[model samples]
Target: MNKLRIGIFLGITAFAIGFAACSKSDSSANKPDPTENGFDKTAMLTNYADNLIIPAYTNLQTQLGVFETAVNSFMATPTFANQQALKTVFKDTYLKFEHVSVNQFGPAEAALYTNFTNTFPTDSAAIEGNITRGTYNLTANSTIGQQGFPALDYVLFSPFHLNDFSGPNAANRKKYVQDLVARLKTLTGNVLTGWQNTYRASFIGNTRSDSGSPIAFLINQFAFEMDQLKGPRIGWPFGKQSAGTMFPNNSEGFNAGISVALATENLVSLKAMFNGNGSGKGMSDYLIALKKDKLSSDVMTQFDKAINALKAVPDPYATAMSVNKTQIEAAYREIQILLTLIKTDVASATGVRITYQDTDGD
Candidate 1:
């Protein structure tokens, strides 16, 4: 990962903490309370199928096409600007990780663990080795330059880094790859746990309106954040690394790692909920109504469908790594759409009547 990404990740993490303090829960006392408004699960489900699930999934497919095309172009002729753009798309796509975790797994730790493993498997030896070794350069005697994208290393390598360009010591290199794979698994597991606890609690569980489920509010906030993060992945192909055989064009880890990282941010927010100062608790209460009317379960079910669709994205480690740019782009494109749609449904589920901003809007 580049410093820019690291910085963004860290910044987002910090912002989450601060954001938790002020708007943790909505005041339910002021609003109308939940009454049995016929709890229209059927109607909600129908609308969800038509408006939320189907549209979101379809949109994901379309975005995937665009992502593939853009990445293909950038791979053939990459530059710094394009690299940044690709990274942006990646960051945005990651928002789905949080959305999927909450809806699919609910608020349980076990559910989160399962979601992370399936969604962002941390078994890629090349990617982890690159990040570990990539922390600094041997010859450069300093960290890789600002434009030095360590994440690129995973793309170019064969499953075991076949060419052995990673280091001079073949034996050490092999050991490194093995170690890296293990480390990635450990790192991702840690990150997933942290992310789930933080974001979900602070945002989703915090708001509990009979009129509007706290779950819905949580997804909405996530979608809003995701829309903001959408540029980097698209820009990756256009980077200096994207054009050459040196970069190898594999985006499997790049995308997966990013998504997992953002998920970490959401978990952080969720953690804040235990505190009265935390956003999760505060936001949940804030959204509840004085009047107890049943919020639609149909929306939640539709949201669930979207979550399942996101979960449908094949495990990153399951597929063979592709060296060809076209193949890699195709893979990324396919996954990108699913991620985008996942965010769309999450936003819709939040049921926030306000016009939510699309953070990544052109």
Candidate 2:
């Protein structure tokens, strides 16, 4: 063989060897061995301390600050001193803080104030009247006969039922804090689940085929999620008020009141759109047309088709953690098909068939 040919072959071999070495290095870089770093238990602890523990502690403190401000303001006013008014105020305030506590810390923290050791005085009408009548002259040391303002007890020593938190009392605080830490540890596992639920909702699905945009889908979904979260009615556990759902006087209620108000507004807006004077034609006319009229079998078929498509969308909570991205995409496509049909046909497309019977009519 020629010397030149032999040299070229040797050079090619060297180049191949160098390329192989580089590839191996890249592969090793890509797949670093987890065992090399061992278990990052300290890092995990640090994450909990920073992300979970610190945020939760800070949130509780902020809530307490708000609670303190509201309570102090209530005490300053005479009308708030009325027995009924005071009960409502306390109930409202307790519900507010209790909700955040429960949502963040779970039912156990929620139950911290379940049993009232000492109740805030609901029968302080005379005191409230006096305080209301003489507003600016109120003192922290002011006494109502031999007894002091029941509100003051809450302000100073944290009551058992009303103040279900880790306070200055080391023993009580330690117990609650331990329980909280335990709960937080459990919640750490479920963070991804909650994240998926919140995250997916941020991306909206296009319902309308003609003018459907991904951005629009996201915006609509975001709005819907927010609406559900801020439900006008009882979205979650807080709606059952009449069924002997009792809360202690010191329990936070202001936040609950705010939620209730928000829910109320949402409902009112929806109601106005569908049934109020804003829409001259009510549900009754639409329902009667849908039910009584001799509509084509195609209409029923379309309605059933749309209903099935909608029903196939997986339960919202099921995808709380991880869901197949393709599954979500398919669900959105089915919905968009139904939306297209609705947009195309006004009469046959709309499948709202409710009987709005008039009881007292002319």
Candidate 3:
């Protein structure tokens, strides 16, 4: 070959090799890390611990402090005005309880916090026996229904059934109320202390999505609480899940007639946790990162629908259950939809194995 032709061929070959090398380098640099492509489990856990869980428990603890004072005042006087003030504080504390109840792991699980704080459809007979005897153990599993918010609901609002707390049992009733509130205060303090002092670090640091990790426990508890909201809180009372038998008294806050209000607060808290409350990292963000946008949107939409439905039902949920059964049913349906999305789509996308037992066949 001529020198000029050889020089041109050599130049073209070198340029081609250099271009290929540059392209390969760019591709390597642009490739996403496998870990990054997977979920940032740490970010989600940190956001949850800081933004949702800690704040929720702290708020509950603060409210319970106020509630305890109110209880003490009411117990000292036991007048109608004092009773009204105590009821107001009790309702406030109960609403706050709704916000933190879904966090059923860490110290909460150890304390059986939910079972201790809000077991509903309280066994009136058991509660009465405890009050009459004045020697019952609050921590015993059999006393679950006789010592939580539900028991307070009975003593505070439905005292009329127990002879309006004006008969011989009045002092016993008051004592029982005091004991329940005091126990709640102590249990809540333990939970708050655990989170603030010890569990917070471990919760945020353990970022795996496996069964034993904080993330899995959170997801499972979240779903379990949603089921609680749908089934026992709404459906069972509406006769939709209890073989078409209306049992309005079975509702949460049934005596105080604020079941819908408490349910609304619970739903609000759940949505906040789902969205991470603008923390820039939540279950919704994690799902979206996993390309489960549809699932995330549907879950959020269902939450809004449920909240709106509950809002439509007037206050005094006991009366509303009879007069506004349709609205309550609608809210229950929306919650069920949300539960399905969380258990199936969100769980599948995130590889979170739900450890809670599902008996509702949903």
Best by TM-score: 3
Candidate 3 lDDT tens digits, 1-362: 12222222233233223333433444333322223356676777778888788888888888888887888777666677777777788889999998887787777777777777777777787777877877788988667667788888977778555344566777877777778888988998898899989988877766556655666676776787677777667776777655787777878898887888888898899899888886558888877877888888888888899889889999787688678878877888788888888887788887876655543557
Per-model lDDT: 0.34, 0.28, 0.74
lDDT of 3 at 217: 71
lDDT, model 1, position 239:
37
Model 1, total clashes: 61
Model 1, 189-255: lDDT tens per residue?
4444543446333332332332234434334434433322222322232232334232212232453
List CA RMSD, all candidates: 14.8, 26.5, 18.9
State each candidate's clash count: 61, 17, 0
Q: Arrange candidates by lDDT, highest first: which order? A: 3, 1, 2
After the best TM-score superposition of candidate 3, give how far the Cα of residue 304 lies from its true spot, in angstroms. Answer: 1.0
Assess candidate 3 and give its lDDT: 0.74
